[model samples]
Target: MPIAFTVTYAVFAFILGSVIGSFLNVVILRTPEKMSIVTEPSHCFSCGHRLAWYDMFPIFSYIFLRGRCRYCGEKFSPRYMVVELITAVIYCLSYLVFAVFQPADWWKIAFSAVMFPVLIVLSMIDIDRFEIPYWCSAVMAVLGIAAIFVFPSEIVWYERLIAMGVILVLFAVLVLIGGMGGGDMQLMIGASLLLGYRVFAGLLIGILFGAIYGSIKKLRDSKAEKQLTEQIRDIAEQWYKNQLDRGVGYVADERSDVIVGSISDGAPDIEWEFLDEKVWVGLPDKSELSRMLRQNITDEREGGFKIFISGADVKKVKYSRRMVFGPFLAVGIAVSWFVGAQIVDWYTNLF
Candidate 1:
C-alpha cells in the first residue's frame, strides 16, 4: 500500500508490457500467415535485413529509427509503435486499477496483466485479418476457467452459470442470424464466465461502439458503393457473357499466380492484396474497387450490384456483409472488464 511500492509496480508493469508488446508485433504479423512466431527473427518487411536487438526495443526503437527501415529506408507504419504504447498503457492502467488505484488485489492484477496482452493480440489480429484466431479465444477460455478457481467473484456460482448460458444463447442467435462470427461468440462465452452478469455491460458497450462505427463507415462507403455498383454489374455481366459466348468457365479463384482470384474467394486468401475476377473482363478498373479490400467487405451500403440478373432488378439490392464484430467486441470486453461492475451497479441502483 505504500506509495513507493505502488510506483515501483507500475513502472515494472510498463516495462514488462513494452517487452511483451515487442513480441506481440511478431505475433500480429505472423500468426495469420501460419508462420512460426518463434523461428523468424525480426526483419525489414521491405528489405530482408534482419534487425538487431537494439532495433527491436519496442517504442524507443521506432523513435530512434525515425519510423523508417534502417536498412532499406522504407517508411514503415507507425502502428507498431502505437501497439507498443497502447500495450504499455494497458499494463500500466491494469496495475493501477486492479492493484494501486483501487483494491490492492495482486490476484486481480495478475489476471488483468495477463489479459492486457491477450487483448492486444485479439484486437490487432482482428484488425489485420477480419477473422479472429480461434487460439486467442481458446486462451481466453482457459483464463476464464482458471479464474473460476483462482479468483472467483462474489456472484453466486449459479448466477455465473446462468449469465454465461444466457450470453451463449444470445450469441448463438446472433451468429445464426449472420451478423457476428462464431469467434466473437466464443470470446463472449469465455468473457461471460469471467465477468458473470457484468458481461451484459460489455455486450452493450460493444454493440454501441460497433453501431457508431458502422454508421460512420456506411456514410463514408456510400460513394465507393455507388462506384462499385457499376463495376460489379459490369464484371458479372462480362463474366456471364464470357460463359455464355465461350461456353467455358474461368474459375473466379484463379486468375493469376500473383492474383489469387478475380476477387479472392470472399475469405482472405492473401494479405494486403486483392485479385478481383473483374480483371479478367479487362484490366480491373480501380475506380470501381475501393482500395480497402482487406476490410473483407464483399458489398457496401446502398446494395451492391446484383451478381445475377434475377427477379430483383440489377440496380436494386440490399446491404449485405456488414463490418467485422471482433474488434468492436474486444473494445466492449475491455471496457466491461474495467468498469462493468460500476455500470451494472449504476443501472441496478436506478431500479
Candidate 2:
C-alpha cells in the first residue's frame, strides 16, 4: 500500500476507535447499573446538564472542557479521556498490524474488533463493580468457537478444549485457595478457549501484574486495615452482645472454633451450616454496623471478617480487603492477544 493511503487508513482507524471509545464510556458507566445505554441521553452526573455535541467529541472534548462539566464546572474523571485515547491507539495499532503490515488479515482484524471492546468494558466494569458480567465471557467463548472453524490450521478444536479444561481446573484451585475470584476465573475460562495454550502466558502475565499491584495495595492499606479491624471488633462485639441480650444466638466461646464468614452487600453471611443447628437462634442483623463494615472494605468480593472468641465473648476481629484483579488480567490478555504466539515461539526456541 502507498504510504499516503496507509497513513490515511491509520488515521481513519484512530478516529473510528475514538468514536467507539465514546460509546464504550457509556457502556462502562451504564452496564453495571443496568441502565439503558442508548435510551439515556448523555448528561453530567454532577449537574445533570445535557452534554452538547461539541462537549462529547471523544478525546478532544475532555481536553477542551478542561475535564469539567461546562454548565456546573464539576470535574469529570480523567478516565473518560484515557479510555478514548487507549481505544484510538489500539485501533490504529490493529490497522497497522492486520491491514497495513499483515495485509488482508480480516480474521485478525475481526477478532481484535470484538476482543478489544469486551476487554475494555469488562475491565472497567470489574474495576467499578468488582464483578465481570457473564455476557462478556459468553461473547469471548462464542468467538473462540468461531475461531476453531476459522483457524483450524492454526489451532485445533481439541487444543482449545484442553486449554479450557486446564484453565478451569487451575482457576478452580485458585478460587478454592481464595487467591482469585469467580469472575476472574470465568473471564479466563473463555479466554483459554480463545487463546489455547497461549492463555497460560496470559495467566502468568496477569498474575505477575496482579501480584505487583496487590503488594502495593497491601502496603498502602495496612494501617487502614488495622484500624478497620478494630472497628469491626467493636461492631461484632456489640452486635453479638445485643443478640445475647435479646435471648437470641448461641454463645461462641473459646472452645467454639474461630467463626469465619464473609459480608455480602453489607450483610453478614456467616457459615451457619457447620454450626450446631439446635443452638442457632436467628439470622444476623444487617444493621448499621454491617453497612459501615461494607463501606470501609474496598474489595467486597473477597472481604471477610474472622471472629476470634474467648471466654464466651468476641475477642478480636480480623478483616482482609483485597485489590481488584480484573484490570491487570485484562491487560495481560490484551498483551497476549498481540504477542503471545511470538512469546511462546521464542520460549520454545530457547529450550
Candidate 3:
C-alpha cells in the first residue's frame, strides 16, 4: 500500500511540475525580452500562429510536434524539452523530500514547491542576461522574509538578520572588487533570508561551481583563439601573394586609408575600407554606410559625456544548468530534512 501511494504521488508531482515548468519557460523567455508572459498566448514566433491545446502539452507536445512549429515549420530549440524535463525532476524531488519524508506541516511543502519555480526563473534570467531585475529579487527577498514567519518551525528574526547582514557585506566586498554584479548581491541577500546559516554552505558551493565553470570556459576560449589566429594569418598570406602576382605596390602607411579588397576576374572587390583619418570626418554618406556611420558617431558623441559609457571589454557569457539548479535543490532538500525531522519527533511524542 505504501509503495503504491509513493508511486502515485511521484507520478502526480511529475505532471504538476511539468505544467509549472511550461509556465516557467514562458517567464524565462518573455521576462528578459520585456514581453507579457501571461497576456501573450503561446504562438509560433515565425508564423504568429497561436498554439493549440494539444500543442501546449509541455514536454510531450514538443516530442509529438517533432520540435517544429505546426504552422510555420520552424524548428524549435530542444531547450524546450530540456527545461520541462528539468522542472519535472525538480517537482518530483520536492514532493519526495516533502510528502514522502512527512515534513512539519504541509505549509513548508507547499512553500518549497512555490520557491523552486521562482529560483529556476531567476537563475535562468541571470544566466541569459547576467542581470537580475530589481523587482524579481525584491519580491523574492520579501517572500523569503515572510516565509520565516508563516512556517511552523520558525527561524528567529535575529538569525534571519544575521544571515542577511553577513551575505550583504560579503556581496558588497565582491562587488567592490568587481568580482560580482549588483544583481548577484541582491540574489545573495534573498538567498540568505531563505537559507539562514545554511547560506554559507550555498555560497561556498556557488563559488566552487563558478570556479570550475570559469576554468572550462578559459580552456575552450584559448583553443578558439589559437584557431582564429591561424586562420587570419593564412588569409593575410594569401592576400599578400595575390598582391605580388598582380604587380601592385603595397605600402603600409599610417596616414592613408587601409582598404582590404579582393579581385574577382580582375575587378576590385572592396570587402572593408578602414579610414585612419580623424574621428569626425564630416557628415556620413546617406545610404547603408550612413547607418554604420551613424552608430559610430552616436557612440563617439556619448563617449565622454555619458557617465555609464566607460571603455570596458565585453565577453560572451554562458550559464550551466547544474550551477543554477543545484543550489536550489540543495536548499530545498536541507529545509525539507530539517522540517521532516521535527515532524517525526512531534509524531513520535504524540504516541
Candidate 4:
C-alpha cells in the first residue's frame, strides 16, 4: 500500500472508531440505567446540560475541556478518552494485522474493527454496573451470524453451533451451581457465533482469570480479618490490665467495658426479627443455604477488629451475563484471528 493511502486509511479508521466509541459510551451509560440511548442527547450527569456538537468530539473534547463538563463543570470520567483511544488503536491494528499477515481483505479488517468497540462497551459496562444488557449481546450475535455469509471461508456454521452448544451447557451448569447467570449464557452464545469453536477456549481462559481474581480478593479479606482480630485482642488485653491495676471491680471474665463497647457496636446482634418479617412478606427465608452463601461471599466487612457475622435477609446479586459477554467476545475475536490467520497461511503455503 502507498504511504498516503495507509495514512488516509488510518485517519479514517480513527474517526470511525471515535464515533463508534461515542455511541458505545451512550449504550454503556443508558442500557444499565434502563434509559433510551438514542433519545437522550449527551449530557452532564451532574447538571444534565445537553452537550453541544463541539463538546462531543470523543477523545479530543474530553482532553480539550480538561475532563469536565463545560456547563456544570462536573468532572467527566477518564474512561471516555480511554475507550475512544482503545477503539482507534483496535481499528488501526486490525487493518495493519490483516494487511501485513493475511490476504488484503477489507471486509475482514472492517469486521475486526467493529467487534472491538462492541466488546469494549460490554467489558466496561460489566465492570462498572456488574450487569450486561441483552441487547448488546443480541446485536453482536446478529452481526456474527451475518459475518458467516460475508466471510464464509473464515468460519463455518457447524463450528459456530458446536461452540454455542458447549458454552450454553457450561453456562447452564454454572447457573445450576450458582456460579454464573443467564445473561452469561446469552453472552456466550453471541460470542461463540463470532468466534466459532475458539470461543470455548477463550471462555475457559476468562473463567479461570475471574476465578483467580475472586480467590485473591477472598484471601486478602481473610488476612485483613486476622490482623483486625489480633488488634482487637491486644486492645482488650491492655484495657483489662489497666482496669485491674486501678482496682475498679472490672471483671476480667467479661473483658474491658471499652472492649465490650467496641465489639458490641462493631458486631451488632443479627436482626432475625426483621428477616422473619421479610420472610412473611413472600421473601425467601434468611436461613436458606443460598442466602447464607450469598451473605458469606458478597457482604462487605466493616471495622477491623470486630467480626460482624450478622445473618440478615440480604439481597442476592448475580453475575450479569451481558457483561461477561463482552470479554468473551473479545477473547473469541482474538482466538479467531490467530486461528484463522494460521489456517489461511497453512493453506496458502500448501497450494
Best by TM-score: 2
Candidate 4 lDDT tens digits, 1-351: 778987887788778888888877887777777899777777778998888988989899999999989998889889988888888777777876776455688877867766676678777876675555677678778877876788677668887778788878878888776545666677777777777766755676567666676566556666655554554444334433443455533323322111111112123122333332321223322233223333333332322122221122111211111113345445545655546445445556997
Per-candidate TM vs. native? 0.79, 0.88, 0.65, 0.64
Clashes of 4: 4
Of models 2 and 3, which has the larger lDDT?
2
Cα displacement (Å) at residue 101, model 3 = 2.4
Which of candidates 3 and 4 is the stronger one according to lDDT?
Answer: 4
Candidate 3 residue-wise lDDT, 112-208, digit = tens? 6776777777767765655566766676687668768874265677776798999888888977764466877776677677766666656665676
Selected candidate, larger lDDT, 1 vs 2: 2
Question: What TM-score, to 2 decimals, does candidate 3 have?
Answer: 0.65
Order candidates by lDDT, high to low. Answer: 2, 1, 4, 3
> Candidate 2 lDDT (Cα, whole model)?
0.80
Q: Candidate 3, which segments miss by more than 4 Å at Cα?
A: 152-154, 223-351
**TM accuracy, model 1:** 0.79
lDDT of 4: 0.61
Off by over 4 Å in 4: 219-329, 332-335, 338-351
Quote the lDDT for 243 in model 1. 51
**Residue 319 lDDT (model 2):** 80
The parts of candidate 2 lying over 4 Å away from their true place are 241-248, 251-255, 258-302, 310-316
Candidate 2, residues 1-351: lDDT per residue as tens digits? 789998998999999999999999999998878899998799998999899989999999999899999999999999999999988999988888878766578898889988898999998988776788998888888888888888887778899899999999998898988758898988998888888888888989999999998998889878877876787787678767776787665454434435566755445556644454443445444354455455555444445667775544787778877567888888888888888888899889997
